[model samples]
Target: MTTKPAIIILSASALAMAARLATELDGEVHGLRKRIGDDAEVTFDDVAAHLVGLFREGRPIVALMAAGAVIRLLAPHLGDKTREPPVIAVAEDGSAVVPLLGGHHGANEMARRIAGLVDGFAAITTVGDIKFGVALDQPPEGWALANPETAKQVMADLVAGASARLEGDAPWLADSALPLSEDGGIALLASDENVNTPVSGLLYRPKRLVLGIGCERGCDPAEVLALAKESLSEAGLSAEAVGLVASIDVKADEAALHHVARHLGCPVRFFDAATLEAEAPRLINPSEIVFSEVGCHGVAEGAALAAVGASGELAAPKRKSRRATCAIGRAPHPFTESDLPGRGRGRLFVVGIGPGSDGWRSPEVSQMVAASTDLVGYSLYLDLLGPLAKGKVRHDFDLGKEEARVRHAMELAGEGRSVALVCSGDAGIYAMATLVFELLDKADGPEGLSDGARRIEIAVSPGISALQAAAARVGAPLGHDFCTISLSDLLTPWEDIKRRVRAAGEGDFVIAFYNPVSKKRRTQLAWARDQLLEHRPASSPVILATNLGREGETIRVVPLGDLNVDDVDMLTVVVVGSSNSSTVATGDGRTWVYTPRGYARKEGTAMTNSFSGDAA
Candidate 1:
């Protein structure tokens, strides 16, 4: 949920419905400026652009609008389904919720969750969701699917009415609606076997093995490994099933135990002696010497049962070398997110720095950057924060390699490192946040990811947008109503940009043109100017702000009729006022641009005696 920005979009007439949806989903409501309700987080004239902005930011959108409207708006901008964010559309009357674009990417789940808010049904289109009520490849919570490919074929077999064989001791499979038979057509085997399963088998690996080891202070690593491996082999257990290694805390750093864990590729855990002692009754063989030294009757078996919790079964009794002892216990359920820390689950922070200025940076963004072990971004952006980059490993790429930069950051994070992907402006707005999500979506963590990479946590810290900075530089040019449209059509089509600009103009909105003019691309701004001129007056105030929030900042206001196109560059933001905007001259002879918020002005109300009689 933290990874994706969830939003709800509605029209002026649906403010009441938007309120309920926002409260239930913990999301923001986007509507027109005229609908100033408690639910509105943002308001704009061009609804399609607002929706596209959310989509580009990798946000999950629950739009309370007609399906056809959303479809037409999204039709041109739709990209890869795996990378696309969830887009759900609900009727204004709350009759039903439909998963539109990203059903597998969690739109169906989001739709179902929000459906209960209005007592509506989720209109799921996927066959797996509609028939079986769950994605067969996507395992249940807390369970990891060992072979996602096998599950697909197995499910296909069952869907075709062929008998399937359900093996192992998973109790849930008994109640499941799987087409089961002893004489197998397809195999759904839930076992702790370390050996590879047949291609025809959908192996559901259970959290069955709890390896207990008690090693001497200077025991040989070879002996510890041999003993643990022999014990697992004697009990016919798979090494992958060994979810934990339980022993006394004093043995936490024991080299032999560490070597044993490294061999099995699991974690080494410790419980105090007294906690192990309480499990003495469950131990198959109690030790008086162990009790006297560590206050536990049994170190191996006792710790094994303790780690597996109360609902565990003793799978392996005690086995011993000359200096070490081992035991195994089977847990009822598989290992979960809580157990992942020991298994090297990583953390990634996508941070925005706000228009190349430190003063405008958020505290949370700074803290995250300070805490990061590795910082990744464009070399110039990294150079802007020279002080923060000290002592941290930095991976800087040239501009236009954003995908490579984000990919490198994810790789570092997946390796159990704390990484920060530094981006300019708000992380969600035209930055790396969306790219990170798109890569994660392609990896299909829920469907299948390596155990270590599967648990990596993702978060984004926002920064001030360049448009806001430009708007603030000039006085209140964005006070009443405004929308930002990027003039650089590198990723977006020129026709789409024109359509959005035309929409903003027709609605009489204050327009903020970002990436207005660059060296390579220069015609879009002129084209936009011509299109907007057809709707607005020639004397509309246009605020031109360049190099804002940085050194050598400059701001000027020009009428739309005389906007200097040659003076504007990529670093400049062009804000064109609506029909209601006006300019005022101050005593210093400088002018200010402001748009009225429609507050009622006092009729004929002025100061009676202020300028002439100061000291009466």
Candidate 2:
């Protein structure tokens, strides 16, 4: 197969599923190594050998296709240093679907993603898997190969009453672990149905949950099930593993959440609209319509949170999602107000320094920085904020040292000082604002930071995330729900990054990619470009911005097919417009881009005015 549309090599059944998904998504798929003879078979080994060659050739691999043998054979080759492509495992009988590796770090995620491409459900069987609602070790992708000794460690931790904090919406869902303390500082809780009672440790009752949910008007059953699965994935818990189902009264009769309830084998309780309306205090951006119609800002989100909070379950970290995979858990004890006593409120501002110029820096941001007594940030980012740093205590650190920076800022803030943790561009868009609140979720971590550390209040001020600056410099490309994906596989693994790229492609959302490529990280951008090619036309516009809002900035708008990989690096930001964003060249060498809002295409629209008193 030439890999037109997308090149996929898998079992016949998987191929069939892929074909169906391509049709549903209005895309195409090409299968490599199709069976030719009667009773012929394509095993995992054949696919692995083909992939090894492909990887060596520096060709992009969206996902791998195999049965059981692929990961085993690929294991030795996939040493600690090398990066593996996304892997999706197919049963010979097509009875089950498995996302075996990189669930979040990327492989398993790829399989689940392919299943999405084919519009098929992956038969996830991991225990405490948030999507399927199973245990962490039981996750399908890693189960076959996870170390025998590691299981003992996990069990030992659980037996010792430690908390397992599931972070993302992966089938292999969960981050690091924290042992529940005997002094009641932290407690342990289960995200699955199989709860084990340890002999001596304190069961940490953490009170937070990240709910991954999808619902339709009046509750379409499938949407509910999808929502439930997503909620489990978001919360890093299993759907069948939930303690209860809290939803709006309208969905009480809705078949899907009910089906999910049955699948979870849990009780479903309907919350009145008033109850949801009253929960506004617990919500960040509660919807009036949702509260009026469904009786809750987030039925699935609220339900998951309520279940965990009431049970004193540990809170999971926050994750980003197109839908509402909100994290709600028990409020940290002594949840003091931001304006408490002598200390300045725990404020987190995602300050955007407006490109590289001091002129573009918002006055509000400057004042806030001046007003703060302590500063926290990457060394380079701190260098940019030097004007506001004249008298403040600086906590400069290297790149990728985010968690420590946040903790120090909080510790400083708790010590009664106004603190500002700085990030370039928009603070909230892929910045420190998120990390501040993530640290606030004391329930989930390698270990809970000291209570004094958790007392800091956090707030996020908006800053420009490179996309806005790049768009304006080129043209109006971000006039819609565009997303920003960092291509750096340092903190986030490449496999997860690829899955997100595929999702963005499938959703047809405009994309602004940060940290697009580096010398050692050449393949990611190419892989991302190849994946985008599957859904978007090769002629789609790509805007490359090097040193945006800074001196020596170079901006180029080119067709996706003609994008030059050499043009990007750590200093560059890549803007890939959605299908709607278009390019038009002027009489000169310059080109301009714009996204149409579709208002011009409306029928029965009149140009003449017919107001209350129109005299012509």
Candidate 3:
């Protein structure tokens, strides 16, 4: 009854008759062969050989076998081959025929063509009658099974002659779509699962899910997935039902997208900024960066809405469902309204002005500062923001005075000013950003001045850390897990510094010495080096960068045993490479640092032994 085309097979004597009939009926005969004659270009033997080879190599094959005894011999020859091309058995007299393997992988179409050759019927076995949904085995090969059991169930239902329904309407879906029926019908859901369907209905929503996130600035995709996963799990959704993923257009070329797509075994679709902007009704509080880039509100709301629409759940009301319960787990970090736009959302951009060069400042950071109304930072940092501070109010203070600066930034932002609290290097690496958050946590601090102050938003943008630039200036001597220690005892005790230095040496971590030897505090650096010598080899490479990237820049690479402690001052950053980090001296007397990639070819037990210590 299906209006699809079919292939027909007939006696060799009847082949001329069938071919002529097909030509007259506006149909063509596509033949197969095992071999090609020298003058013929290709023959029926070549087609048969190609089909057999496809079966042998596990490629999907479409074969039309006549009801004659030839199929019995061919089926056994298909033996031991885990993959078989689809084979449709037809009667030579143009009677009924059924497709066997790789039906959706093009076998059905192939059979239909052949059925016309022999004047037979092609029985397609898939359920959804509209435009037969992709078959279980015929889906893109690399796609992983989000729910193997559900797939199995679908097959069982089909074999039992149950009708299948295609739920949820996606614009990308073909126009011949049909509504899903509740009477034990299978639902063909698009990638996203957010439909407004109620629970207790025959339709079951999947719980195991994946959230695809595309971020502009400041948002880490890894962290976003982690948080979204945690939220879904906490909501009683299984980690498995998340057959859905979400992302913005900017991440179209990101490796992170392929990584997630391959893991979920789902196709990814990107939405333009305008389409997503229409879904921003719920995203009332959007960030300035998000607004400028995505031209909309939060990505989560938009992505979630889009995903739900894809899953055929958009028209269904949000209600409890009973097919299965997926738990939504607690998130490591929760998004707040302040994380939205225009809310006392002050961000701490820890910029690593590489080598203190103007060319190294990122254009994005420049735009952020230009958009700010106030700047909170040390006097040195105030100078760094000079170009962008033409119209902005500057709350500059002295060095070693961070509490006041953090307080003022929060206060200004509380009054609705977009503030940028600056740090010299990466704000997170023992810089001003961490201190700001620590103060923000205190109930009595400036961050908690009033209830109106609660919505102040905060963020940290990574910059070039002092150690990275210092290492590049000297040599590649810092190629291991390294610990940085500030020698100043102003806030931390000297005894603690000595203990940490010894621990770093014992653990074989490369040590980046910060605030190493100030003019007034010369002995601390010597004492720290002495502590390191107790656990590390004396021949370790010790690199010192003085006035790095400034007018009086001096980078020195020396052995740990020959380090001159007195030569180092607060402006100097000292790096002592670990034992694993090798030092090679070039012909020009320059030494470089190098670290091995650990194990490369080891497999099985040998690989286990290599990482066993870390596992413990």
Alpha-carbon RMSD of each model: 19.2, 26.5, 20.8
TM-score of each: 0.45, 0.41, 0.42
Candidate 1 lDDT tens digits, 1-616: 2332344555567777876776666555566654543235445556877688778767788888888898999899987766788899898888889999877667888888878888888898877666655665655444446777576676666677777687886665655666677997677777887656767777776755778889788899999889988998998887767766777766754678778777766666667788888888898999899888878899889878887888887789999999999998888777654553122335789998887765677757866876688999998778766555655799989988988888788878766777989998889988899988887777765543443344466889989888788777667778788898988788999889989999999999999898899888878888888888898887788888887777788887777877768979877888988877777667775666777776425566431111111100
Least well predicted 10-residue stretch by lDDT in candidate 3: 607-616
Which residue pairs in candidate 1 collide? Answer: 194-238
Candidate 3: segments with Cα more than 4 A from true spot: 1-355, 444-450, 587-589, 597-616
Q: For residues 477-539, write the lDDT of model 3, one tens digit per residue.
A: 454467888888888999898888878879988888888876678898888777777777776
Q: Is candidate 1 or candidate 2 better by TM-score?
A: 1
Top-TM-score structure, candidate number: 1
RMSD of 1: 19.2
Which tens-of-lDDT digit does each residue in 1-616 have in candidate 2?
1111223445455555554544443323334444421111112335666556544433324342554565665566664322434445554333445764434334344446556554556855443243333333333421221122344355455645555433212222233333223343222233232234333322221212223233564555555556546545655453333434445444433455556656654444444455545545555545666565665675544543443444343344323343333333432221122211112223444465656455456656765675677888888787776434655788898876888887777777655467888888887777777777777776356765554455444556666667888888877878767888989888898889989999999998888888888778898888889899888877678888887766688887777876778877788899887776777656775676666564435786422111111100
- Native-referenced Cα lDDT, model 1: 0.75
lDDT of each: 0.75, 0.55, 0.52
Candidate achieving higher TM-score, 2 or 3:
3
